[model samples]
Target: MTSDLDTLFSDAFERANNTTKKFAPDVQLRLYAYYKQATKGDNFSYNNEDNLKNAFKFNAWIQLKGMDENEAKENYIKLVNSILK
Candidate 1:
């Protein structure tokens, strides 16, 4: 079941990322954060001041810090659906 879900989430994630239709900034951040959380979990980190973009991404990812991968994946899919409507 988990594997199936992972596969499903992967497809959804790809769709979200690869869509030529542009998303609003807020929606994009949600997608970015959810994607990072789903894929990287606790291993995702950005501790350096190398780039402001990275800092924003780090903050966004941290906002969803407590979410597990499956939950994040679910949210990712939901977010995509909402934006599509």
Candidate 2:
């Protein structure tokens, strides 16, 4: 059975995905980082592409290295709720 945090995280992901409002770059990066950290944990890998956007994403996610998945999920849920406010 899925944990409560996992269910809440999935609901938050759905809300974030369905939102129509555009967010600032920093907010977007935070959402991206939190989502990645929650889902992929610390085992994520990215290609060394010269794309600045990819680099930024990698940096944001890397900063959350060693964060627990449940913690990341909680953070992501909080952010999504704040944004939807």
Per-residue lDDT of candidate 1, residues 1-85 (tens digit): 5687788788787787688899887788889999889888867667795688777778888999879988998999888877765
lDDT per residue, candidate 2, 1-85, as tens digits? Answer: 9999999999999988898999899999999999999999999798986699999999999999999989999999999999997
lDDT of 1 at 17: 68
List clash counts for every candidate, in order: 0, 0
Evaluated at residue 35, the lDDT of candidate 1 is 88
Pick the lDDT winner: 2
Error of 1 at 38 (Å): 0.8
Off by over 4 Å in 2: none
lDDT of 2 at 21: 90
TM-scores of the candidates are: 0.84, 0.95
Highest TM-score against the true fold, candidate? 2
Model 1 spans with C-alpha error above 4 angstroms: none
Model 1 TM-score, all chains together = 0.84
